[model samples]
Target: MARVLTAKGAATRRRILEGAAELLRRNGTAGVSLELICQTTGSSKSQLFHYFPDGRAELFCAIARFEADRVISDQQPHIEDLSTAESWRAWRAAVIARYVEIGRYCPVNALVVELSRTGPEAEGIVLDMQSRWHTLMTQAVGRLQAAGGGCRHVEPEAAASVVLAAVQGGASIYQATGDFVHLERALDGVLSYVGVA
Candidate 1:
């Protein structure tokens, strides 16, 4: 069974995770080490093992979850309110702006690539995040259809899936080329296909 942490213990664990995440974002997964995490978080080796008994692998999985959450949370109010044409446009802009701000360095993608070959747990975390994101977008597309704003004939789930795929592809292209045009064009093309643009 998992140990039940007191509030203070929980806070300490969160601090370690946040610090590690920052380190990973700045230095990449291969560059981050347990000692560095400890120094950054001001926690001891015992505390690190106390929280992550399985060592670096376990700690990395935790960071993967954190970065996954960041991917969705960073999109904010626009991602959650994607029901209308206006809302969809705003969400698209938010996504573009976020990628532009991050440039070629995506922390979550880095984690995914680093940890995916290690075990199923890391892969599952990323897949779960993607699934949840797709579900949200599917719901939003359904809302647009109900409001008679999007194409009535298009399947919301399929459309959302395509949108997610397009965005992922665009992000990969952006990361490779240092250009946002591909991302913007992909988003605009998907929205137009759904009759939202």
Candidate 2:
């Protein structure tokens, strides 16, 4: 059973998790260590173990979840309100700007890579995040069509899937070759298909 943490204990756990996430983002999974996390967060190994008894596996999974949340929350307001061409364009820009600013050090991707060989949990986390993200976009597409904003002939579910795939492909390209053009072009193509270009 999971331990029930007091408010103070929960806050401490959160502090450690956030600090570790920041370290992971700054250095990638390859460069971060638990000791570094302790030093950076001013937490002891005992505290970390108290919060995450499974040690690195548990802690890494927690970070993956945290980063996954960031992936969606970062695109807020625009992602939530895509009822017009203006909103769609803004959402596109928000997506591009976010990835561009990160410049390939995506903690979510890093954790996925780091934990892929370990087990299925990391993949599950990514899949869950993607599902939630795609659902939100799918709903946004439905909203646009219902509002008579655009995408009249487009299929909401498929369009949203394509948009999500475009982003993944684009981000992969950017991470692989540090090229931004392909991601932008891919997104433009999908947006055009959805009649928002």
Candidate 3:
């Protein structure tokens, strides 16, 4: 049976994960080494293996989950409160802030690239993230309709899809070009489509 860790052990494991996350972000997963993580975290080989017996692959999976959680968490209160007009603007601002803060550093994309070498898990993770993103947008649109803010003829689900695609596409472009015009244009386009601009 697997051993349960005490609070100190848990803290140690988290320290190791945080160190590994930084390393993975600075250097692609391939560029990170076990020794580098150990040195950076001051963790022994046994300790590392105690947390991740399967080795680098196990660590990578944990990082993938961490990054995935960050992806959603970064959206924050805006993501959960999209039920209002003010919330919509807040969400837009949050997205812009997050993108600018992160710049070109996309942990989820990096994880996908590294894990793709292993098998279907990478694709599954990507798809799961996408689904969660769509759900957030869809709920926001639904809230707009329930509040009678949406255009009478607009189809909430379809509009939500367009809006999400636009945001993601614009973010991708901004990541490459370092210009936020595309993101702005995409958000504006979505608002315009909804007759809200």
> Considering every candidate listed, which one attains the maximal TM-score?
1
Clashing pairs in 1: none
Deviation from truth (RMSD, Å), model 2: 2.7
lDDT of 3 at 78: 83
Ranking by TM-score: 1, 2, 3
How many Å off is the CA of 96 in candidate 2?
Answer: 2.2
For candidate 3, write residues 86-120 as lDDT tens digits: 77777778878887787766555555555445446
Q: Write the per-residue lDDT of candidate 2 for residues 1-197, one digit (tens) a residue.
A: 77888999999999999998877766766677889989999999999999988887788788878888888897897989998888989988998899878787665456455644345786688778888989998999999889887758889999989987788787777877888898899989877988878
How accurate locally, in lDDT, is each candidate? 0.83, 0.82, 0.76
Backbone collisions counted per model: 0, 0, 0
Q: Ten residues in a row with the worst lDDT in model 3? A: 110-119
Query: What C-alpha lDDT does candidate 2 achieve relative to the native structure?
Result: 0.82
For model 1 the local lDDT of residue 80 reads 72
Q: Which stretches of candidate 3 lie over 4 Å from their true place?
A: 1-3, 111-117
Winner of 1 and 3 under TM-score: 1
Better of 2 and 3 by lDDT: 2
The RMSD of every model to the true structure, in order and in angstroms, is 2.5, 2.7, 2.8
Off by over 4 Å in 1: 1-8, 25-28, 40-42, 101-103
User: Regarding lDDT, does 1 or 3 come out ahead?
Assistant: 1
